[model samples]
Target: MSNLSQLLKESWVLVEERHDDVAAHFYARMFLTDPGLRQLFPVHLDTQRRCLVEALVTAAASIDDPERFTEYVQGLGRAHRKFHVQPSQFAAFHGALLEALRTVGGDRWTIEYDQAWADALGLLTSNMITGLEQDADPAFWHAEVLAHERRGADIAVLTCQPLQHPLRYQAGQYVSVEVPRYQPRLWRTYSIANAPRPDDTVEFHVRAVGAGWVSSALVRRVRPGDLLRIAAPMGTMVLDRESPRDIVCLAGGVGFAPIKALVDELTRFNRSRWVHVYLGARHRDELYDLDELLRLAATYPWLNVVPCCTDDPSWTGEHGEVSEVLARYGPWHEHDFFVSGSAPMVRASLRTLAELEIPADRIRYDSFGDI
Candidate 1:
């Protein structure tokens, strides 16, 4: 237990130290050992590894108690019910995870450390198992894409049809994309851009993050015939199933990707529920998918779409920052909200949420870690 404590603390610090490195290598190691899991991702494994690792590190940093953490970990077991994460796959991931610890930890990872990690891994996986069994399969799941528009240098609105089979996902849940780009091994996160029912191939709202390793690689290098790998679906940041209060959603730039999925799900499931979304962009030129959103708002009687622009020059649309738009729409109480976009955007929105006096139980979001 002492050794386990030491390892847990050290692992936390290590995660803080080289988060991206640890995350990137963690997935690479997993893929190297279990190439069979390769089909479960859409973006490059390297990229996916980093994002997942970072999220893990973030969760670890936020957790305050072993008992609570254990419970929290156990909660994931229920959350993952919709994802269909198999016990066997969880076991395999743990095996690969240990291999990664040894590989990444290198000189410092002794046999004793291995033993400690094995215990920790057992605890973590056990919780996952519990969480995954409760939630029923979502009504929809599948993949399809059709090109919509090519912007500036090279980006396309890959319009997708509904994935008719499988199960549907809540908005905040992001699907793991593992695809063969940048040497046939990449995995990354892409939020379901739009909401679709079961039996719908969800859309991902994406743009070139410019110097990005994966997106840039995809935009510049990858071609039409390539297959994009995606995990069945997983994540903690979905809508609250227990409540039906007024809901507020926040999104920044491309962060809108995941929240959009939630929005659509809300519309379909709680057709009468009041849900609002805030999507942000720097300026008009940087704007994307506005018409579609307006159309959605028009179609959905209970949903409202608020577009916030940093520079709404003509001021035709909502002006000022995203929070201002949030404030204007809300003197809201007991609302469930989701926010997407950059780190700054998340921070700003949190401040907005607090200022609005919204309850702690209502807000939901996924941060891209740009903060």
Candidate 2:
């Protein structure tokens, strides 16, 4: 790591545990500095605060990897466009961030640390500005919902068509979605559940979390014909077509979205590579898309689908955490792995991959934090 990256990471350790306080301070200072800026965020700042802190931590940790850092920050910058961020507002944000850091750092704060962070933020903001200005795509697209189906009480499958332009995206990428009718300014991210289709429609699988503003609105309230806003897609979990290795995909609950998309894409040309998909949920009822996946498996001899249930004793298939069951099936050290689901599930699966001595480069997942 560069001296600046080292310093930033070291300083971050001091405040990482108290990130909630840091977020509160940062936003308080920013809004206090420019009261009108408060209008730019959602009314409930709980999830937003966590997202801000996670973004900062991710950016700080990535500084040592130039390629990763550039791609992430540029995407972040472009993503921020949906918020209608103004260039003039960056100065206030910068000041507020530094103040939050200094306050949380307490006695450990030093001139060298401050200078390192200043330099880092300068680089970060400059690239973000570059990303914001160079992008020609619109900040967001308007899509009309074409279909909506509830698989269970909380899970919903929805499809939509972009009204003005093609919603071009890779098979495994995700996009932020906004329900203008129910939660206008509050946007949530969801993986596009299918490969790019000929008709320019996209699919999303959403499960409502308790009191989750956007998700509950999507599952319980959204219907066919509703107009929604779709932001530019951003993620790096897409297939590496040139890699000749076999693949392993682990999906838990609705995390199946991107995994399904990848499998859908693979079906078009894959004839040699063996693809294994492990779909896990708490109960048999929650294995919402198993029948469809099984049909795909039957149609494609190279594809294999395994359904796992953690809590269902009556489940006839695998019975354990998906990651644990995955451990029994491999010979996977040579395979490329794609993992998705709740944070705990992803973490456990990653741990399993690590224990199996999987190379870091051979595994990919979206760790951008809760949608």
Give the TM-scores of the predictions, in the order they appear.
Answer: 0.67, 0.97
Model 2: what TM-score?
A: 0.97
Best by lDDT: 2
Q: In angstroms, give how far residue 203 of model 1 lies from its true place.
A: 1.3
Q: Which ten residues in a row have the lowest lDDT in candidate 1?
A: 139-148
Candidate 2 per-residue lDDT, tens place, 200-224, comes to 9999999997778899999999999
Q: lDDT of each structure? A: 0.63, 0.90
| lDDT by residue (tens digit), candidate 1, 251-278 | 7877877766676676666855787777
Tell me how far candidate 2 lies from the true structure as C-alpha RMSD in angstroms.
1.2
The alpha-carbon deviation from the true structure for residue 18 of candidate 1, after best TM-score superposition, in angstroms, is: 5.5
**Model 2 stretches with alpha carbons more than 4 Å out:** 367-371
| Residue-pair clash count for candidate 1 | 43
Show where candidate 1 strays beyond 4 Å.
Answer: 1-49, 59-122, 125-144, 151-155, 160-168, 181-183, 217-226, 269-272, 312-315, 369-371
